[model samples]
Target: MAGIWAISCKPCELACVRQEVHARDAEAQLVRLASSDNVLSLIEADAGVLAGMLCSTSDLADDEAVSLIERVAKLVTCPLIVMCDRLDPGLIARLFYAGATEVVAGGSSSSCEPVSSKEACAKGALRQATSAGAVAHSKEPAKSASGMDAYAEPARQVHDRTAFHYASSMTTALDEPDGLDEPDELGRSDELEEPDEIDGLDEVASRKAMGGRSTSSEPGAPVICAIAGRGGVGTSSVVGLMAATAARMGLRTAVIDLDLMHGNLPALMGIDDPVDLARLLKDSDSVSETAIEATAMMVSPGLTLWGSLERPELAESMGTAVEQLIFALRDPADVIFIDTSVAWGDAVAAAVAMCDRCLVVGAPGPTQPESAARIAQLAARLGVARTKMVSVLNRCTASSLNEEFALRFEMALSLHSRVRIPDGGSEVSGLLSFGRLEDLARGESRLTSAIQTCTSSLLKELGCAVPEGFGKPSEQDSGGLRIRLPWDKAGEPR
Candidate 1:
């Protein structure tokens, strides 16, 4: 039968698909399936009867959409076209990886005031399906202009030679070389014998299944990773302050929020509505320098901010997307800072390994040192050199106990470089309330001096040319720092 199957849970999308299908081919019947399971069932029952499938992502989650497309592609001979509200490069790549023949954007789910060219998009989908029979036997995954397979799973793409070691550990016994086999007394190879289980192999497998990039191809920005030993240790604040300090010194700086789940970089930077990274990923055709520039939110003349995921649950699946984003930002800024969560996941591991400097931030406490030690050990396993790591103790007071904690943290982290930021007292709270955390580097307080010192030291370590007058206090009346206390009037500064 000359018919098209429309798959969507949304009524609006289904109606749009019906209208587009009828407009394209009046004689072709449009069969609407409300769920992926229904479509799968139909395909199983009569795989040869279907002409094509028009799937919409509006009704399914990103992972769900990918899974459905992959399952359907494996079962059906007809073309599988995906209709998304917007064309996100990451989503498109995933869909293509799952064997989608074509992806069309600007459907009924589009947020644009006037819906974009649905007729043309629908016509293109129909045309692609019409030509599917001629090329069905020769279909291959899409490749980028760089000749790299664009649809290749990012996890499967080895970033460097060291990746082979990690890959080897995860490889199954079946993948082992035949050289590992030995002949027994009966003259049969021992290849079929059950091997002894190794300790921590299951944990390694779990992490591998979870997910986790390089800095760039060319010599560009020195990437820095700011990771916390635990939550509330002020890692993000430190990154914001350091990046802002460097930018204020006339250096082009960028901060990427690698904490895909619960990232607060926008709020800390006083940006009420930052660009949604997913939208930027969709709008751009590729992960080039221009695409990264479009994704960045210009905080000031020299500083830029790249936000995290709009949906926190999608963080697990966004490791590759984040890596690609970091790679794209290499040439756009002179220095790059990555703010990562405390959780030790694939994304955090990748960031720690790829950066020029690893800023391990922790609070002054008994447990923080142990946490920092664990992070250091993990970074070592991930191929980060000890010399590249720098430990920072936040909220440090001049008391003897706090000083002792600082020594303990540094000793545990085992890094030559260390920085201590004094507790900002009430002033820090006021700045946070006002969404002016970046101003921590703009005052004469101990916190500001520590931030500037850290920024200068890291830049110097990376061989980045520091401006002639960098880290010096400005001459426009070096007045005492003024901040509005919570008890004071709204317009007053103490």
Candidate 2:
């Protein structure tokens, strides 16, 4: 069971690869690479299959592509599949000559092919590699390049639909500390890699993040925080979609509105006079799971909601209470999402500080990237590791300016991975504005599918199992390329 490891600094590309890999073989374990450093580490540690997707024309040059292929090929024995965006015959030849086991050329502007075509190309490459006896030569069948087990114990015992069931069960087991036996002196955990930090914090910060609670040692849901430097970037909308989607997948999910001043989740969710998170925070000294649960408005089965204060008077005191609320929700929800306010302040910082993972939503604009960079710096100062943060390009349209903004964000924020959310047209906007999010979640629009893709990527990063029936999201034209958000030129209304 030598699994496949997909290496890419781009979130969208790696996501495409995961979809192709899973569709081709559900039992296969997919590992992601965030940087060239991770690539070096993976090459040194494990002998497994590898897949790499080149950047779009705007982000990557031909020489850089050659250099990357050469460096990776020189060090590893695994089979390699490379997908090029332009599909130039010369570039394809150069890639194969540089050590790529198979070169794929379908993402070109001329092809206008869907991601399914790219998936098929990758699948063909993998099949050729397997037929050529690539997996037979691996050092260990069950180990991946990261030294983590490629598949769980149940993976070997199931097939087809039952296979995903086993995988989901495996994810549940991994999320629970009690489900695992004690590790040896190395502080290791079974199944997954040992956690280097608690919520991306060092030893001292991990202890402080717990606020004197022992919850860090317990098995809990992953807390995800979504933030945008300013408003109209779809931060709250993204948060709602993710929460609803996770709930539909059978995970108990909770959405905490940290936007104390002007929270829109209550309105967007169509909940009239929802429970204010401030009420739960006022009794922070005696806050318990029961109290938190009592205040939560049930959006659907497995999904719970909590909104911010209706007015801004108590905004100042809600900082510490945000941390307390997150701590209490750890036991009940499989994933807790904090929809932080658009502004940077104590509340936003507290939410970022407490999250296991953070999604920075930036629309295409000079100011958005700058604000995103500032948020990244703030997170770094608060001890949140850069690896735990991902930039999400929301409301994206096709434009070179959008690409520039995304590139600036990547460079300024030092972020390796990014997910793109396409601009859903007026119809999608109408649904969001009128509190018809469930329609988008169950609908087939590009926005709906993109959110699903984003959710899958996050779940994979957290070692959770993606639910069944998640078909591949629709790909963009010109190799899945997208540029700007819908409201970048004009201020988008909430």
Candidate 3:
């Protein structure tokens, strides 16, 4: 008996596909391919016995999925249906470009629907692929113009219920008389041409502009967690400044507001309406790189901000979601900065433990140093080493009391690195309140110089190669008016 082959690394997704196939046609056997190697071997061994193949994008990256489809299409004579978790037009277009006979959504348990509903959608898509015989038996697969149309009608019957049908309108521009050009070895065309009338061209353009997904061979970027010993110590300000500084220095930076409750990064960055991360976390399993890209708001040229929760009450339950978000950001960013709340909740603990360095922000006072000590103890318990913890004395003044607080904070944490930011008075607060961080970062002031110096020191310690002339005075300050402070050396205290 002919069988239907399915490829998915996720067990739940594979199970759904299997159940759906069995429900639709009990006589049709279901074969699950665990990896790409298995897929090619199965096609080579018995391509004729397979009725169709179901490929799920839930487990694979976008580029990986497109490459797999292109390779299988070149050899297999059966129908290929791509199972997507969401309805992303760019991804669907690419799947069809790579020779998918049909594209359907909600094949994984990550969908908003329950498992039963997901299974029903999978059943409809499978039934259409096998019954319609979406592809012709000719040696070369039928061109997109005709092949896509053949399966489109049957797909529409269940369109509202489960599947999405792409007719000639979606692929008319792709059907050149010369036929589809072979994609390069990396599954990219030498010259990528977009259809003039694609539905989601704007989204596709944005994804491309954002550099798509990271295919870097290097390990993921380091994560830096900024936590304050107490409220009003300017931890969020420090994090925002550092992120903005990094982006200005030609690094792709991502800032995550791990504070969750009462996160103010969006406000500080001047984003009036931020993405609702709480809702995205509600379906953590559905969170993908694509989902993250959609949720992230590009604040500047090289800076992306993943806003915090709109509803503060949802903070406690979002620990797992925070972890998922960090994992998803590993690829696309050169470095990640996390602004954590003063409260040591599950979210804060997770960020501290996973960070490469913990920046403890404190202010000059008797009580704040003690609070810094407590923060140090908690960080130690959370697996952060003393050497990896950097201390910052914010709102510093030229007084013995400020020096005393700085000494106490360093001695308590046993930290080798310490930074000090002179009080910017009300001006800095005004800038932050109005979301004018860019102006504050670029302004020629003692506070701006201190923050820029601190940012440079942190980046160097993180092992990132600093660009030429980084942290130098801007053209406006080129009149030899730059002042050097005693704490210019990042790791040493005055």
Q: Please tell me which predicted candidate would have the highest lDDT against the true structure.
A: 3
Clashing pairs in model 1, backbone N/Cα/C closer than 3 A: 87-282, 88-282
Between 2 and 3, whose lDDT is larger?
3
User: lDDT of model 1 at residue 235?
Assistant: 88
The best-first sequence of candidates by TM-score reads 2, 3, 1
Best by the TM-score measure: 2
Could you give candidate 2's per-residue lDDT for residues 208-247 as a string of tens digits? 2223121334434567888777787788889998887776
How many residue pairs clash in each candidate at the backbone level? 2, 3, 0
Worst 10 residues of 3 by lDDT: 155-164
- Give Cα-based local distance difference scores for all models: 0.58, 0.55, 0.59
> Residue 84 in candidate 3 has what lDDT?
78
Give the per-residue lDDT of model 1 (tens digit) for 139-161. Answer: 11121111111121122211222
